[model samples]
Target chain A: MAPIKNGRHLFNEVPVGYPVPGKTTVYDESETIDLETVPLNGGILIKALSFSIDPYMRGKMRAPTKKSYSPPYAIGEPLNNHAVGLVLRSENPSFKAGDHVWAFLPFQEYVVQTNVAHVKLLENKENIPWSNYVGAAGMPGQTAYLGWKIFSKAKKGETVFVTTGAGPVGSIVAQLAKLGGLKVIASAGSDEKVEFMKKIGVDVAFNYKTTDTVKVLEEHGPIDIYWDNVGGATLEAALDAANPYARFIECGMISQYNQTSPYGVKNLMNIVGKRLSINGFIVSDHMTPENAKDFYDTIPAMIAKGELVFLEDKKYGLDKVGEAILDVQSGKNHGKSVIVVAEE
Target chain B: MAPIKNGRHLFNEVPVGYPVPGKTTVYDESETIDLETVPLNGGILIKALSFSIDPYMRGKMRAPTKKSYSPPYAIGEPLNNHAVGLVLRSENPSFKAGDHVWAFLPFQEYVVQTNVAHVKLLENKENIPWSNYVGAAGMPGQTAYLGWKIFSKAKKGETVFVTTGAGPVGSIVAQLAKLGGLKVIASAGSDEKVEFMKKIGVDVAFNYKTTDTVKVLEEHGPIDIYWDNVGGATLEAALDAANPYARFIECGMISQYNQTSPYGVKNLMNIVGKRLSINGFIVSDHMTPENAKDFYDTIPAMIAKGELVFLEDKKYGLDKVGEAILDVQSGKNHGKSVIVVAEE
Candidate 1:
């Protein structure tokens, strides 16, 4: 512990726009967190074994209380994500020192915890990699399942369309839709991603770079459900292709982040003709801790049954966090980018 | 019967567009529909009575097809609407000869019916005016009600915003929202229509022609539900002001109809942040004979109590039919325009 040194690194504030590499200075402690060394009843401290860098974190960099579908992260606090860690100390009966767990923990080296309500205790399984804890067995996987299963209300023999079909959330979404008996169609930015989708159960996957989205979609008529990750043009194409009474689940919009450029949609009138139903979501906004179980349980079971495909683009360490995020931002990541902060 | 003499004069082929009025010769029938000479079918024969003209008939006029939302008027056939008529004969138990009925009938001298399924019998409604069968008491009323009530899933004390607020469908939607204990905000193209909305329960009304839709709606804070009868830019403004999980019941897009032009919505990415839902519908899409009961029961009672406002901008005589159609197309009708084919 840095208690003897009188100085330790803690996260200072939420960043906006492009954060300069390594300029984010972590301080000794944040004002809100109670790091009382005396262990409180049923409380523990966890040293993070694995950390995640996700696109959802980008949503949290604004004012904490923006009344949007997603709540913003607070300023001047250590960032936290779905992290798997080893319990270093515990007063909690369920957790002991050295027991492995996946808790919503900060991007810091250590997390002090109490009331392990949102934390899921992890048992080491040799066949499953630890990075998957922040991906397939964590939030993104659950998002893929719920967004496809409930949001789309996907029907058999219907076509399911998705944007960013190679990313963590959308790739899994397409896989789950395929398992649910729907024909899967997807759009990805690169040729590699398009082919990746085909290998993973997509019926039709088009490279947006070479293909006119509307033309490609028209070739595959009557999309019944659309699971959207890239918004703007792709979403417009989805709208244009939607049959009457289509359901559009807006899981993420990688297209509409910080920029001087405008977000314009030319085909909104299609929503009226098609009687489409679209909804935006931050999975955490609607999914509670118990619901998180529903997300994890179904997908892992699906994978165990050989009914789902899962992929992760893992970056070696915390040093590559910027590169990992940049890959997602540049539409280069084939799937979810996981930060292997400290290899288990 | 003079069918052998002037069969061509009685019916017309469908004209392609506005430059050519219709495909039949304008040979005048010197003799009009006569009650004494016409052979009436025993099942039911509706004497040409008052019928309702609606905005959506423009869509029908474009092309008669299975692909379209509604079947277009057939070539060489009289135009149809919500007609209120006197039944001269009926073999069906639901009606008898000389019974007054409200049904879907054409703009002809008399309509012979072998069956009467999609119809309502007018037994003792001598107290209410016959045209009321086509206005607040008819399809337009049902369009507004079912579109907002059932589709939008609108909740009381929440905000309901509608475009084209003073028109028959939008106007009644505003009233129904008000009755449901919601705050009603509406927009109309003209200052007079704004005044009309203000007169009938609209809490806030704007002349969209004069005001910036985005600015006006932002002033109203977040909109919980948008009942969009006029899409395009007004729908865009609604999208920006929509709260998370907002429902947009898209009943019509009259703003885009006259165009050799298509209007583009520029801010549709707000669907991701706001999580808005848009559904297009014809009141026909939701109507079951059972759901029709809510309209048939509540409307007469609402009219009797003077809680519902009904307006008609009538053009007198059969010759005025062409001008009336043109006027309604121009969006110049102050309210529902009916042609008086016979004396009341």
Candidate 2:
């Protein structure tokens, strides 16, 4: 085939605060690749289908010297995240042409995968939307499933307070808690998101921006579990309203990610008096083969059977990746933000 | 028997900040009780021996409307705490005259107990000092033991950082962590206390007042477990120095107990990145019959065998109760502060 236009989003510069589009990240479509002859080195060549834009990616856009759970993105390199792609050509037996696969892929139109260690072949027998694989049935989905399964330890009739309830991970966690016989109190930034939370069967859904978090919790809670996605004031509120021995699952703190100075949580002393258990976890750590298998066998089937659902805020084309990430960081995106790089 | 002088410390007023020595706690000695004629009411009339003065008592000095794990002290009532006493007379079958017992007794020269639910018959086969029951072999010891045993999940070759390392609970936790084959890094306010920490087998002991806590932890740690006794800046430092999956046993937060505004912990975001598990507990909650039996069987024997040791800062008379509590609240007492009310 002739050389074709290949678009990519490159990490341009590390930002002091919230990343600036076109400055922190540069969209480059000047590059070209010969689809039929790109070097694979016994690996597969993939055409990017969709990319998951998440708040955690902001943590990666830091100075390389700063240590975190995820490594910093190298300046001038393609920003990478969870992406679903089509295997165009393959030399590896595990993947073949026309097979859909999910892997940590760079934000680029085409990828030449020399190492296949992080790649997993996608099996969509029920034919769910390709974007769902990057959102609901993908990393975020597994994050909610594994985190809830391993940590929440939810008992029937217990109350769970979930922050960022309309977001990918929180939505799933809230649904799981609701289905598992828990009284779910969830919060989101917007009234629309709050309505979405109510639609999803949340017992008490509120717009955190308008409501006093502590008062709401005091009136409706003494939450047995706290699924914390937006940390800061909500966390302090949760602590105030938590029942004795409440379990706090620290998944993400999207609110503080872009701040130059993180929020100072005051009432941490409640941890001692209430005998609260606060656990912080990175979901990728629990993605063992057994756990992944269990997640795939259950969550997708639930989605297919209409028992579980997820909302996607889709941004068409690679050019929208910067805006999508910023939206996720600022809580502007109402659901799992995804950049649909190409149609299947 | 003739009437005897019975002195006690009474809760006089609730203060906003630190409990005042004479104003918040008043020394009352006007009332005298006849040792022979005092009504037992199916309980026991006891002569108070030694009382444990701890920082936790500061929390009980709040308004009655405020809820806490421990009930707030009633105004104009005698202050109560862990005490080792001798039964002067007994109407209950469980106790006999002259039998030593450990119970939650008022800080008084003499006490009349109607309910024996909180009392435990003291069996000192080795005849350890009566004061030790109110310090080393008592609640503080059990607090250290059970908190360490149940929450720490410590493994050999791991590192543990303990704050308030010379205090009753932290000292025992430090020693226990040291003996458990973990690298123990402990901090104390004074140089003398740091020396005591070293003597008790802490691998690295520092005076937190003189040395920067975060610097010391960074140099000696990546702590696997944090036995948090002083929970303000030190807790934040521990979070910064913690290894992935660090277990924090939130035994106490003495530093924040008296502060009107609790410290705003800025680094709780580290909880998620490091995958930390912080568990707060009240030792009394875990004191089931089985656990209490295990603790009594093991800890006392350990003290007797010289496998465990504790320091006691003894206040000679019941008049010193107010000062003792003040000293404990301010972290002025080097060891387990106890007011010796009477001789056994």
Candidate 3:
């Protein structure tokens, strides 16, 4: 066994609005150490297979503040994210060579995972692809599942309006609502994404960039539930279109995230007359182990049976991590954005 | 009997921002009639005792549109409100002469109640004063009761922030929250109201006119529940200071009701990260007969035991209805504003 070089992406500076490529630079730090030389301390050495790029990461790129849901990514430190990896070595004996695992790890070619709490060994009994863990069957999928179960609870036969229907969490939410017998209305930024939404069984899908969302909602909705992903004008549109006793699930406010001054929602008075309930939540706080089990027990089976479809916009190599994040931020990703760092 | 000349206030025009004195005018509509000449049509002829002037009436004074919680007052008709009265003559079998009743009747010296459904025979069995029915024991009391039961549901020991702490609905909500074992923090426009709140067992009371509500909240809270009466900047302040899983009860937005442009709520993004729930409700919709029973069963007893105190800002004469409404709007009323149409 010989020493191997590891490539990682480090957070260099706090971003003002949208993060650029220069904010983070690719760094390759080489050290020669194999599995045999690794000390046993309930940790595992692994090669990163794939990582997820999500809108929430943008919150972390801001200057370190207590207000954000997650801690700010420290400058000069490797940006960590949900990733799938192959465990080359394990000191704890719970994991071994060639074992596929999922953990919150950085954008690095190779790494030693010391926190046994975050690292979980994958069963792979059904031979589900490793990259799927970072996209569909992982955090995003769990997020979609719990969001419906806890926040929105958009009932069967009710009309649901979802924003950013092409994004990771929103797309999953839209599809699940469809599967649960809801009348799914979705909005996307591009015609291609609208078409994709339509293909995914959305009852009505519109390109928000080219259409007035309020008009679209008025035509297609008296929405019973609004699953908010992009929360500026779309939120106001939803407020205008909400029916009596409507429920609004506040997921992410991607539209307001980059702006210095957030869009002031003006139609909140409707909440009074219409008896609307607006609830915001972070999936990380709500998703328990039991919830994860419930998700894994049903969703993966549905995926294998073709009853559920998950799309991943795959980007290859560690160097493309910055670009992948920008794609998510700009709503350019066709579906869940994934950076494939290494081949299985 | 000689022709009983009746003086009543009529809604003359749609108010733009706030209802002015001239938007409604007192009219003397004299008609020759007697108790025997009153046609038997399930109705009761009554002499008015007292009637309420509420903040919600401001919303009704707006242009005739379907957007508000209630219908706009018909321009030429007398303005109707919750009133306590003495039944002078009765054609309906349910009511008889000398019986005291409460009904949604016009602001007049005398009236014939044709609609039997909206009238309820007063059961002042506890020897409760009839004028009290027009204030704390009536609509405003019911509004406060239902607001807490359905919307806020502030748990025992949780800190609850209430706006308009000296007004009708808010004052009752604050008192009830205290009785329910909550730490009550309240805001009022005047220092006198602040003192009133402090006297009513509020843990902390601040004059919002002189203080920053957000700063007050930051000092005393990570508020678990916010019972909003005055919306706008105070509502925005509540949003900023809400704790995780906080509940916001949107009872009224009196602050924005008269504004040409509503204040934009800017901190709504916090709803997601903090997992806060904001629910708006119309008390009329939630106050069912069963709810009224629950309220009457407990609240009246609490009042009798000196455990509860209700303040009434009573003005004499039907001609003063407009002035009373203005007082409620300007936050000049010490408590629930009531017009004594005639002496009981």
Candidate 4:
């Protein structure tokens, strides 16, 4: 396939409401995003299909502007997080054309940035659906592996409490913990999510909206690990229900994201008292360039072993980009939200 | 000095009011207080002169408290924190009679215990004031040393924000930072403290009670290392003023100790956004028997070299122990509070 000629870029925009406007805008002139352009220099160009719409992105749109696991998004600057794409062009000596890649990318059609280290320039893109690269095969996958393997140390028979049990990272983490032979207790926002979590190997799954977080966790008995994807009241409840020396792996705090003020986790003081280790981590921080080899091997092996089963909710066409980001931020999309930009 | 052989025991209590009826109940007993003889096990005899009444002691007062830097105090029993005294007798083989040890001792005159790892058996007391074993030359000294060196990686010309700057750890840490050639900005509660800090080597000292934390910090400009003693508002202010990639060493959060419901730091989001490293540490965690010698030697040199000056706020007698603890907790003690139990 040859490179497309320069043209206007299309993006999604939102009007004020429950759903940000699902409208599209076309720029009068094409912006040169090539790495070699201006003071910036990366001939690097990746055509993104799977961009992560994480809970942290919604935090950027907060009303009073609250602090988040990730910085709040400015009014509108093409929100970015994790993305798995194919390198269409490579200026760096390390990368080659047609290479599969995963990097922190924007909710846009293309990304051409220099010095994006956490981004993995993948060698094999076969058998594994490109979508999984953003889901079970990609960052959400790594978030689970590193968090459970390193931070949480989710051991066999240990109980894990995971918030947002049906979402991307939380879902994978729950599955991984279960695979590691740990008992999983999870909190979801909706009944459907609860059922989905249970179906995917959670021992105890509850809709936090319908159940008292503390009461549900209490009924679940003792928990040794808390995977915090939803970090407001559930985090507090988990803290109250934790056994001594519990590990709370803070993947992201979706519950408190868009609120101008923080969603208070009153039991945070328990961190010091119980000798609990509550570590807030950006999954990218855990990944090294070499981790990609494990990724290329594990995703396929997990699939063959019937270990990892993941889902994707795709919003197609570049025009739907804004709506996709909105859906991603609001956490309305089930599983991972990926944008299909000129799908191959 | 002659030892008492009264064959009688006295449980004398002095009241303090911070976390609770803050009291130090000294044991004036001639009867064996050994763990085998007492109602409980694991007891050793301690001849106490100075007991450390630290900020962490407040956490122990609560029944089901958060994870702590120090061990929790048992209910209805004598509490232990950092202490300096002689071992009168011991069931624990690591200790013996007339051994001048420094421990996180019980708030008693004599402590007979089985848990000796809880105590740091002293080989050298150096004929220094017993209070120094718990104050400037002790835990606070180590706290400052470790917090600066370990967590903050304190460097020259970099700005440092130290709250409760007139207190033991803060004062010692400030001078140490000065010796390391860093730009030090301190915040305390009063004018007298401001002057004392200025006299003993603080480039900028603001009275937190008088000046605004945010404004004062901004006026001082970018802070690279924040040695937070007063958590809550001062911590929030420090967070607001910190430079990108700044390090926050949480040595103590004394400001929130007295609050029944602890306050949330409004600007804590800065930790993630700025990529700041905010670490909570108890200096005791960094010390060992081998390093304790080095720590002891270093302080004496700095003091003798006039590179460090220790400020002592003397309380008249052992009975004034209650007042000294209260004064320190309330920030009324301008410097290190020394209980003049016996004259050197």
Best by TM-score: 2
The candidate with the higher lDDT, 3 or 4, is 3
Give the B-chain TM-score of model 1: 0.88
Which DockQ value does candidate 1 get?
A: 0.55
Flag the better candidate by lDDT, 1 or 3: 3
lDDT of 2 by residue, B1-344 (tens): 88978998899999888888889999988889998898888989988899999888998998999998899998999999999999989999999998999999877888899899988999988678889998878889989999999999999999999888899899899888888999999888899998898899989999988899989988888889999888988898999999989999998888888888888888888989999999999999999999999988888888889898789999898778888888888889989998988777
Interface RMSD of 1: 2.1
TM-score-superior candidate, 1 or 2: 2
How many steric clashes does model 3 contain? 1
> Which candidate ranks first by DockQ, i.e. highest?
2
| CA displacement after TM-score superposition, residue B281 of candidate 4 (Å) | 3.4
* Per-residue alpha-carbon lDDT of candidate 3 for residues B1-344, written as tens digits (9 for 90 to 100): 65656778888887777677755544446544555566647788988899999988887876676566688888878888899999988878999988988888876777788887878888877777788787678888888888888767578889999899878788888999998899999999899999989999999999988998878999999799999887888888998888888999987888988888988887788888888888888877866789878887877676677676878899988778888888888888998898987776
lDDT of 4 by residue, B1-344 (tens): 33443221112332234622223433333344442243324446666666655666555555445344455555445555676777666666677777777776555555555677767765443455567777777787888876676677777789998788888888988888888898999988899999988987899998888788889888996799888777776777787788866877766667666666777644444544465655556666668766667788777556556677777787654445555666777888867775544332
lDDT of 2 by residue, A187-206 (tens): 99999999999999999999
Better of 2 and 4 by DockQ: 2
Worst 10 residues of 3 chain A by lDDT: A24-33
lDDT of 3 by residue, A29-125 (tens): 6444565676657788888999989888988887675566688888888898999999888876788889988899987878887877878888866
